[model samples]
Target: MVTANKKKIGLLMVLPAIILFIIMTIYPFAYMIYASFTDLDLSKANTGKIIGLRNYLDIFKDQLAISSIEFTALMVLIAVPVEMVLGLALSYLIRNLIGEKILRALFLIPMMVPAAVGGFGWKMLFNFIFGPVNYFLNLFGIQSIEWFGRPGSARIAVLIVEIWQWAPFVFLILYAALQALPRDILDAGKVDGAGGWKLFLHIELPLLRPIFYVTLLLRVIDVLRTFDIVYMTTYGGPGSATSTWSFYAYKVTVSYGWNIGYGSALCVILIIVSAILINTLTKVLNIGRELGLSKE
Candidate 1:
């Protein structure tokens, strides 16, 4: 009876936050769904007559929307895998080092740096006329290239900036997982003459499976929503090359015009995609029960 009363009190304590979430997140999302099916525009104070599924259908046909989706997919595919692999390797290297603590702190510097600042720094680094990147290229007798002025180069630039900023997060997570492995199994492997590749393949990699999958899912989800670095560096340009869905959504709401309905539609699509990703990941991890328990 006492436990039940305590639980009820705890639930009551969190009721305000739950109400705020409903107001802020749930209400806005519900409004977006309603607005998406209308001809809502800012000039009309975001009021409009119902238009059915026209906006959604129009979204499918929009070249900019399609391009943004493709770019977002490519970014996730490229950045997440590369970062996970690199971070895992870095984690392994640092795990047994003499000054691992200090080294881990140093590695987190990239993540600590502000996103806009990091983007601008990379922008300068990739500049054609005066950047050191071009200077280095010249040393190799290669022509100076305008990195962000070209579509392919712009994509690469954004990818690099993203990888630079977020790789440490992957490293930290994987390193923690690695550190938590059973020492007994590792010792047994050593006794069985397992030195490097064989030991990792047979033992460590298998143990790291859950962490790898979780990290992959998280990074993929995050990369899908990438905006700030790309925004600061490219502004979704050199002809919409670096535009992800988030940037495209921003353009719809703010830059191109204030088509609130269209922006709301785009946001709805993003939310759907994110929901699907999260659901798929949760199914794969089978952590739903554990997550529920943690909430208690």
Candidate 2:
């Protein structure tokens, strides 16, 4: 009876937060769904009406939207895998080195910085005429390249800043996972003449695989929503060349376009895509079982 009462007390304590979530999150999303089917231009708020699937269909016709989708996809595909691999490698590299604790903290400095600030700093660092990067390149007999002037270089610059900021996040999580492994199991592998890469491949990799998939899924979801960095650094230009779906949606809804209905439609599409990707990844990784997310 005491245990059951405690459970009820706990539920009662959390009841307010549950209600707040419904008010704050559920209501807005439900409204967004209603708005997406309308021609709800913010410029003439009261003059809008439902327009069926036109807002969604119009997405393909917009060149900027198409480019933004492509750019967002490119970032997810490139950044997540690279960060995961690089972070895993760094975690292994610093496992037992002298002053490893200090080194780990130092490596995490970039991750600690806010994304907008980091992007702005990188923007200055990559300045064509007088940036430190160009000065260093000059020492190596390379010409100062215009990072922001060209679309390709601007995209690359954004990618580099993202990788620099996020790789440490991946490293921290993976390193913690690596440290939490069973020492006794590792010692047994060492006893069986398994050292170096051999031990890692056969034993450590299998043990670490679940955490890796979880991290990969996290990075994918995060990179898909990247916007702050692009906004700070490139402002979604070299002429909208580096615009992300999130940034573009913001533009359509609030910033430049003032088309709330269209932006809501774009947001709905993004949400659907994210749901599909997350569901697929969860099933393929079988992470639900690993994370005890399943009743089984």
Best by lDDT: 2
Off by over 4 Å in 2: 2-15, 289-296
lDDT per residue as tens, model 2, 1-296: 57988999999999999999999999999999998999998688484798999999999999999999999998988888889999999998898899999999999999999877788799899999889999999999999989999999888988999899999999999999989999999999999999988988899888988899899998999988888998899989998889999999988888887898899999999999999999999998899887778866
Provide the lDDT at 163 for model 1: 92
lDDT of 1 at 287: 50
Summarize candidate 1's per-residue lDDT along 1-296 as a digit string, tens digits. Answer: 57988999999999999999999989988898998988887766647889888888999999999999999989878998899988999988897789989999999999999998898899999988999999999999999988999999899989988998999999999899988999999999999999787888899988887778778778888898898998889999988888999999999988888788888899889989988977887777765443443342
- Native-referenced Cα lDDT, model 1: 0.88
> Clash pairs of candidate 1?
none
Off by over 4 Å in 1: 3-12, 44-47, 278-296
Instruction: Give the CA lDDT, 0 to 100, for residue 188 in model 1.
Output: 98
TM-score of each: 0.89, 0.93
